[model samples]
Target: MLSGMKVGKNFWNGAEWYLTSWRSADDPSPGPYRRALDTSGLPDNIVWEGDAKTYRAGPWNGRWFSGIPEVLTYTNVMEYEMVISPRETTYSYITKPGGPLTYIVLLDTGVVRRLVWDADARAWQTYFQGPRDVCDTYRKCGAFGLCDAGAASTSFCGCLRGFSPASPAAWDSRDTSGGCRRNVKLDCGGDGATTDGFLLLRAVKLPDAHNVSVDRSTTLEECRARCLANCSCLAYAAADIRDGDVRSGCAMWTDEIVDVRYVDHGQDLYLRLAKSELPPPSSPQAFPTAPVVGGSVAVVVVIVLVLVLIVIRRRRGSTISGKLQPCLSLLSFFFFFSSFQFLRLLITAAYANIHSTLDVPGARSCALSFPCIEHQLSPAHSVTSSSAPAPIVPYVDLLTLREATGYFSESNIIGRGGFGVVYEGRIPDGRKVAVKRIIQSPLLDEGGEAFMREVEVMSKLKHGNLVQLLSYCKDGNERILVYEYMKNKSLDLYIFGEDPKLRDLLNWERRLEIIRGVAKGVAYLHGLNEEVIHRDLKPSNILLDDNWKPKIADFGTAKLFVVDQTNPTLVQTAGYTAPEYITERYLTLKCDVYSFGVMLLEIVSGRKNRNTPTLLSDAWESWNQHRITELLDSAVAQPEPELLFELDRCVQIGLLCVQQSPNDRPTICAVVTMLNNSSSQIRAPKRLVFDAMTEPRLREADHSAKEGASSTSNGSHTIYLS
Candidate 1:
């Protein structure tokens, strides 16, 4: 409230002293700049004119800033506390008994004042004034200094007893903040260990305290002992200095100290320094007494690593999966081998600096660097080593997975899917695995139960293209579903030019194989007895395995419909969506057929519909315009001529599935039968006709762009009738 900077009406949670004068009675644009308690030193409120520190309320005593005479009156209106000790000294105001006219705020403008509302007068009145003079510029002195603007010296800068300005030239120029430096560097915790000491400064502000460890129950002596023992522990203090006595609590610091100032009342801070960094001692000093210390440095590090590894290893194995370790391990091996091969080529004979030259025995050959996380997690089984094709999610005991992943860490995230993310984890025996995370995001579903549908549906169905659900966590708001990590991730990478080799790897044979796998998966979803329609299907949803097999994943939005039963409204996606569903809201197995047909064409063409001139138009042009080759992804070569025939057949099926009239499309059974047929030449589909009753302008506007831009559209429907 005191800074005079306004927070907006909407975001403000009404703390009156700031911006608002109690309520919104005043113009809140901007008030004069003013600042309050800076705890970097003995706590006090100081008003300023930009560069000049104008007012001083003095340092905080255990009860109040000693210089604030108004605080004595402050007791009449409200009981406020001004505290000082070691960890920090602070100044704050709160209401007390019978104290309705309360508010001690730093006023806007360069004035330091306390305000009290006169309820009867219906106005606020200021009772306290600060910055009586120009002597309050903090750190007015240069490095190694103290500021007493009232000083009689010709030069304002004064070096402390033993320290000097870091740059005497700069000191003359009045450059501070780069205060002082010890002429002799301290022999810090380098080498073995060294002696150090603390010099006490009385009634002064403590330096910045960041690495503080506080203990309320500990006494002053106990606090000192704690700091002396650890090489890193620098200072200690009793947080609250009260009634002219130190009270409970301790705070310790470990780094360089900066910015100390004092008021009429302030804290006593004990600082740490190496013996060399300290002043010449008046009396011989004993190494400050330390608490009992145990264990070698290495031993402690190893013990800590052991405990951390135990916890993290388990979680990593379970959540993100330890694929990172395996991945790194794999990379490390390649680097190692590549280096060795280069060395063998470069050196006369097998090199002699084997051990000394960063090379180890048997490491030069094709030896595993670090065992893959899979080997570490489970020695008996590869995370992906199911005798039968691995389930989308393997059925493993919870304990086993827990033992594998070191409990998911930042390093575990490998990939993500619509339903969840994939994490690399490791198992106990050191096997690495990937874990899929079904995240809970507000944008996808608001209520917790909406995600439960996926569990219910996936629990009963299994198919190759369908990503298998490994396990689910329903214990809390966590509606997490785990699945087998598909090593190659999704087909998007291969199809999208994100990875060039990806396309080449999936040659004609593999591409056709992926098509069939997907067809079968979507076919299963549309079967008679257990009809499941995948409402969302795309390249991102299709995951590829280590062997490049495509698996349809993320059935969270999938709908299970039965034969003869149909949805009355929109369910499937557009483009891939059956025309009947988008235009008139009628859904059938043909809906999934339509979607599957889109996916089939996508796999063969290695192109996305959203990126095309138009999926249907592209298909039509490819069929008749001699640009058939352009339809296939440029990254991948043409599939076998026989396979090209299958691609053509599938493309035709896709068109039939997307016909404007649902009745015009063949049943899924007939389509699959034709797909399964080895000798049958699928019948060509009739070009769909648009309704003519609609006004030409509306029809043209409503018509998809892909249809308009690629061709003139002046001729009759170009049907390839058989």
Candidate 2:
């Protein structure tokens, strides 16, 4: 049933007809070849074989089959009509006040029978049946071919006034599958314009209409003229099948004709033939005729593009040098595509309005990072636009992310922290990166405050040992901060791993390098006149690169050790937190120094200070006993007295920084200079009393958890102690 059609039991609606197959054998279940009123195309009843064209009732015109001298009786009992438009098509029938309801059905095979129940017979009586014999084979004669069901003992097939058998042998054997062959092939010279003509095929089931066009607006004369204008047109049918079924205009077919059947009720299919082969058209009678939305052509095109980009990213994302780059891109596309568009429009419009002296890399091209003008379309890693390194760093945008972790996708997730996750990202095309995304809330005021402080600090603080903050974003609540990715990750990877040889990655020489690098970063942070202190420093926070350079990260919990200021005290983790700060809320640069000392000890001994085992405790106790060699990492295996002295000095410094007094320990700068100068004299730290090392005193070290600090995705967050 096409779109809109009145349905009822006597009418045998689509549902009723469809369900008949489930009825019992005695119940007279209808067959599978579905029969329904095809309100579309001219409007007639058509039987279909699961989307395959089986047969059709050529539409009703005002008169008879136009070919079959019948259907004039149609008005005697009922009124039938059809309406066609670009939007939809429908065929409807209504009978007089006391008239009977009518319906059509396809039998077990392909036979079409129009049945009108007889009150006298007490059974369904067929009013009409079509294509009853072999001669009724649909479109047996093919395009321009006609069939007569009443032929005497022989298949009645003949050409419509024109056209010849496409295959002569097949025709002799009665294999009409040869269809109707053209007498002459079209000569569509180079010129697109050409002339064509049509032979009227009547009383036909029409041709295989898989490909055809219908137009009801034109007259029969106009239809002929239009057919003549196109060289490729193969056939045409009445625009409306209701009139004479003669076809008001023409349903044109430019493709091969198929599925033609002889029907008592069929329409004229005007088949195009060579001008020389067509009979003169004195009269207009032509027997015969002729995303469904979201992902339409346009939407499909975008999805295709998105898939292509994702593929490219996957390939490039897995590169060892840039693991997370591709993954980041997918993530960005999923979450930030729309946000990016808005941001892009914002930047595109703002480009000309702003002026600054800072020589940003490809400045003019830097619209929120897309940098249309300066944007370099890199085919690979090398041969980027020729330009010296620019000193200016602009605010980071989503595109900069693509250049970073390749775009922060799955392959780029270097590590998953308790809070947010860590992604290996890149900055611009050449820079490698680590992007850390925070997965917690921002209502605590810590996120924004810490972020701004980081940018302001990273903006001016430059040191080889500190992780560099490339940029930040507040897309929705999606807070992302990008930094340079360290190739070797952090110290815990090598020191805590089961592989004894893993420590080889951090040999004594590399360890010293990391120590110095960390000292330098700490020194740089403390050097700020405003004084920035890393309140939550730990070994994991210290990342190591391929060159064994140490860079400190995770500033979410860092505190500003202002020279003279006071508010929301009790900063820093208990274990690495300075004793004075933990006991008295005395935040200072010395707090970080203490944490750094603890980290240095971990690096040297391969043991966590807070979870010290008997070996560690005994080793430290033996340190003062001059048994330092016993305290060296088992992975290190062997150590010289000089290395022992170095470890001892670091341990002493760490213990000194953790002293119960705020004024005793060295500042970050002093510690850096102290650790760097080989010949410089450094005071040995005073050992604490027995009570300090007792179990009871060490049990109260859950300040961070007790204070309920909002853990960041990176396992870093500030603990507010009001």
TM-score of 1: 0.37
Candidate 1 lDDT, 1-722, residue by residue in tens: 32113211111342322221222225555455556454443344555455555445554434555444335545555555433343334344556556656444444434444556656535454444344222234444433454432122233345443467877778666565466775554445644355666655433444444335656557877887777776777566565455356555676766554434432233556656667656443211222112111123333444455455556657767554464566445555655555554444434222321211112111111112221111111221222234653333334455455444545555677766444566676655454556655555443444545445546556656566667665665544444556667888777677766676867887766776676666656655665244556766767778888777788876553432111234343234334655555554566667676666666677767777656526665665575432457677777866644345456556666666656566767766556544543222233454544222222333345355536656865000111111
Q: RMSD in Å for candidate 2, one decimal?
A: 37.8
lDDT of 2 by residue, 302-408 (tens): 55666665687667764542555565566557545554554554454344223210111112222222211112321111111226522433567666665566556
Candidate 1 global lDDT? 0.51
Candidate 1 minimal-lDDT segment of 10 residues: 357-366
Q: TM-scores, in order shown?
A: 0.37, 0.39
User: Looking at model 2, which ten-residue stretch has the lowest summed lDDT?
Assistant: 713-722
Q: lDDT per prediction?
A: 0.51, 0.53
